[model samples]
Target: MAKLKSAVVFLIFLTSVLFQAQEREFWLIDTETQQKKIVKDSVSAVKFLDSLSKNHFIFTELKNVKKVGLRTEIYYDKGQNFNEAFVQLSDSLSSELKIEKQFYTKNLDSLKKEINKKYIDQGFAFSRIQSKYLGKQNGKQKVELTVVKDQKRLIDGFVIKGYEKVPSRFVKNIEKEFRGKKYDEKNLLAINRSLQNHTFVSLERPPQTLFTRDSTNIYLFLQKKKVNSFDGIVGFGNDKSEKFTFNGTLNLNFKNIFNGFESISLFWQRNPDRGQTFDLQTDIPYLFKSNVGVNMNLNIYRQDSTYANVKILPAVYYHLNNRQKIGLRGTFETSTVMDSLYIQGKDYSKKGIGIWYDYTEPTEIELFLYKTRIRAEADLLSTHYSKEEITAGQTRYFLLAERNFYLGGRHYLNIKGESALLNSENELSTNELLRFGGWNSMRGFNEESLFADFYYYGKAEYRYLVSNQAFFDTFLQYGELSSKALGLRPKLYSFGLGFNFFLPIGLMSFQISNGSEFGNEIRFSDTKIHWGILTRF
Candidate 1:
């Protein structure tokens, strides 16, 4: 078996070199004036010739992998010996433009027959020819011969059928992308690739084609597919304040499940103290083929805190494309502060329904570490019958910026920041006090410290891939929340950093933070040290 394989490979190599149209010339002949016209070897470049001679020139008895190369021969009848008359015309053609490789088949009549017959097998007319030279040594009597390969005409029109689910209109629009092209049999087998590229469409079958309109048109048959899926998430956190919490969620979605043009999703999340939520959503796409998707989610939440007590929300989201997204979210929320042993009822929560318009835009930047994508979100909250956020509500102006970076090798980093401008009329809710020493922020301090009017958080992490499906991650963070705005007030800053090794099946979250200011008696309210299985999915 090994010897057979070796023989076959050698045969193929010989054929490839033999077919190369090395030292060959080409010219256009004029039948009426018997004049030879040389032309630049544009399409017949070196690569083109190598591809043509690749399998036709060699003599071999062994059969191996089907030999194939680029198509090079395109002939036309001049009604005279034009090829012969124009033999020397190739020398006068443009010298600047050169052939990458001018390859031709030599001493292989069988290969010519094989190629001409191959064209016919593909539905184009085919034929083979014989040529001989007769003339005065150099400028002899020129004669051009036409080896009649199968003759075929180009296609003019096409028809598509068997399309379901994939809007016919959309398919028709895509078809326009390939209109003035021919039915290359080789390419015909590959043309169906476009259907696979349609993100919204699921292809169930390969395309089938047939000739139409006097071989000038072809009708293609197609079939569309349907699919569906789901996602789940869970998160957990704890701190030195002896506080712990768990959050879990489930999302179910169906695409092209029934109405073909639409999809639906149901979501629910449960959290202790942090609140719980349930949402239902649906969307329709390409109603206008603008690459736009419109969806709506009905949401409800229950939480008893200083900033937000309980909430019932209904939101609509629209994604125009990758760069921008706009959403109008409304919530009927009740805010309240949990009674504490020390603070009593210092925090407050009110019930109110508010509608907000949120917009987020992301831009990419090339950074020294790697490429980073920064996203900014702005929201116009407090619509409908409601007191102005600056006048009564806590936050009137909210702005948040987040950046994600791709670290070279296996390291990945992400940074985020959020700020709010509250109206003087609205007192800061105790429950809204910026918390520290938790899973996300300053991990060294207790998780329930909201003393600051404004706070900042910075974090960094390094990851190492341990296996095809597992990795080890370590992270550190620093955060501060001051009693004054922009952290100028009596600062309750927290500084702590920790690391954890996370795995795919589960994760280990760890942290440690210090809630104190510099130049002051640095006393550790506490050092938070803990680990758990939790990684946002």
Candidate 2:
């Protein structure tokens, strides 16, 4: 009797366990679409169906989860509140809004957020989602969600703090453009970037929102900082031809003149190689209220004993977007080369239409530990020199890439490379050929000491930040200049240690390095000590 009883107990226990397992099966249904998804277990069914209420369109619902036999059936429907609210906002009215359905649960969540954002971006300031379970439907369970799109706000006016003398018309125009439109984050960011580019003001902080009874307003707070309107340098240097030299430059910049987005600049430089140079440039952005602008430059260059040139460039440039630009220029030149033993004096007039493209992206400036910046340009021109007896074309290409990474709190890695190709007709003159080997180029050689048709430069540095604005660095540079007719030696290499200071005025660096030309024997007598200031911001 005891053994029989024990066996009966074991059989009952097995049956109970199997029954509980069978109760876990379920089905997930989309009533409007008439589609069903089968779920194998109760735990998974509950989790998935519960997620649907929070994961569908802005106001979607998973209505029910009721067990019938071994299967749980889930019921889904649209929320009436959201459906009816949007109906008033649209031209067509329906009692129930057709839910924008989503397939994959993974993407359904993202789509729901995007839908809510559309209302928020359009000034529905109090829009939100609310979900709840509403018992059973047809022996299954029910859930409902309601979207509350509370109020629609319109832009009233703008308040700009700082710079009190700004014209009211200018403020009114800016406000008129956005007064009745939707307030969007992206548009605000674009405006900030544009203002920074033209006005030299940083708008990294977002505009503050102020609410009134009828609508909303935006307040832009401006912080004024040092503006780079004037820059000049004074220095002495030696080049390949001259053992000693005098150099100085003076620049004047007048920006946003008359509040019409205009820039005028005048530059004058005196140096031994070029004697005296003067340039005047003017830039007008958004010319005639369009996406294109005109730029004019006039340059007068004179070398007392050697040569002189007067060049004029007038270009119309189009901005494809923020990161890319293109321009077409008509150039005119008149020149005279002094008569020397190897060449006769000549006067020439060359005219050409040149096209150029520039691309720049500096996306990693704010990232931690690493950063990257890229710049590239290409220009082509074809001209006829009447006195030189050459009908020729010139092509110029330049590319630069820089990478910065922090190895630790202090150690940093910097790698930079630059390559240029200058091509012209075979009968090009002495002043037209390309040259390298300077503090800015090969680093340890005399200025303009290497002539080439093409050149490549690479630099690598390991640096330690001594302060917020200063760094100590060790660097190596390699260069290769190739020429066919000039027979100039090609390979140059250098290594050095330097300290760099990044001041508000510019970047200043000092370095001492030894350069070597590799040939039958390596000769390394060029010990160069270089220091300079550069302010191209």
Candidate 3:
């Protein structure tokens, strides 16, 4: 974004005069030396032309003498018998005209001053302009330019490494975005955005390139930095009946395959009403590039001074893309509940192992000028649903997609659509299906707070940012997921608003909603608004 902005600025600089002003003659004044030499370098020549537009010759007041001629002997020798000159074609001596000329002349001198300062600014003692030829014929002039430029310049190139999840050829395609280009640091920064658009990379503000290396290579060297992510959440919270505590997830992720395609993290949350939770997770990717990964999770919970469920699960997955993935997963899980002494059924289901493959693809119809990512998945019984002799045939199909448009600088308008289905004997239900609501989802809703079976929802979020200062986000969600067993909902709706403060201190968020369950009768308290703070290291 920064790089694109600068390119726009540069283009505007070139067009500012051309956009509204008439062309003029080149008033040749040799360099201030005993044997003045014309500029011989393309870079310097182009810069000199630009500087001329800002020099005294163009923007300052012409001397009081009313003659039109080039000044040859030192400064402003208006009375001239000169070797070279650029006389104004029409010598209208009106004060208004002179005032305009003076304004232009003053601007030119200012530009010259800036050009002289650029050398020092760039750590260069001397700048030699190399294109020196100029000619005129048939009342038209031709200025010479050089094809090669040898000016010393510094640029942070785009870096690529450890992309094991993607084919090298695909990475090569992204590398082409920066190769052999002029190292305009500002433009490079903006073009780096292409990384976020790619389906494979996790979205984040990319790291800057290390400054020391070969600046001229087809594949430039850009050393990447480590990544740290913070998750902030506030919520009405859960079916698991957790409290109204602020929940947060801290993720420190990596893109380079150097340390291997793996990630690890620790999590803890507390609430006044509900119990608390401490969980740990680890995931490994590149399981054959079809988006396969291994997920392990263990959670310890307690409330009212008693032990809650201590659940453990290890799941292997195969996801095709950020929008979709298919995996044949097997998990060994066990649990213990806090208040289960009088409970008829076990607080948790014993270990159940199964393999499921799922997939998603975008539908052709465009919404918000974009198509929805369509998907479908089916899981057959690789094993029993439990130690008991019963097997579950699970299948689900879904379509979800989002598109955004810029409202102004930092403010953006986002639109989304989603739908899904679930079949028999599946332990995962509406409560487990994830949607856009928490950190990285709906800024105001709790993480995984609002989703149900066989449902459809849409959301609009307006996010604002102030460069390095902070970012603010607010969104509205209206949709529900339903399931028959949980009496969840086939028809549900919620519309809410929320915000986040993305600052150096980390992230803070708050959200509120007024809606009901997916059923013939909508219930209240079934909905509420909330707030939270979260960060990571």
Report clashes for each candidate as comma-separated counts.
34, 6, 38
For each candidate, the alpha-carbon lDDT, in order, equals 0.44, 0.62, 0.44
Q: For candidate 2, lDDT tens digit of each residue in 251-365?
A: 7787664554567889887653546778999987567656577899998876667777788989898866544568887878777776465363345666667676655443222
Error of 3 at 136 (Å): 6.0
| Cα RMSD of predicted structure 1 | 14.9
Measured on C-alpha atoms, candidate 1 has an lDDT of 0.44
Best-fitting candidate, scored by TM-score: 2
Candidate 1 segments whose C-alpha is farther than 4 A from its true place: 1-308, 322-324, 337-376, 380-425, 432-459, 464-468, 478-537
- Model 1 C-alpha lDDT per residue in residues 452-523, reported as the tens digit of each score: 555665556555544434445555554555544333554344454445444654344444444455456655
lDDT top scorer? 2
Residue-wise C-alpha lDDT for candidate 3, range 1-537, written one tens digit per residue: 234334433543454345334332222233332332243322343344345434323322122211123211111221211112222212332231232221112232243344444442452323432233255333333223211223544432445544334444344444544454444544455455434333234334454444333453323233333434445444554333534444444333333344334666676655424446677877665544334577777766554443344556667776443334455544343333344452322333334344444333322211112223333433332223233445455454546566566677666676766666645464542223333344443333445444454666777766565443344555666665665545665444556665656545655666666555445453353345566554434
State each model's C-alpha RMSD to the native. 14.9, 13.3, 15.8
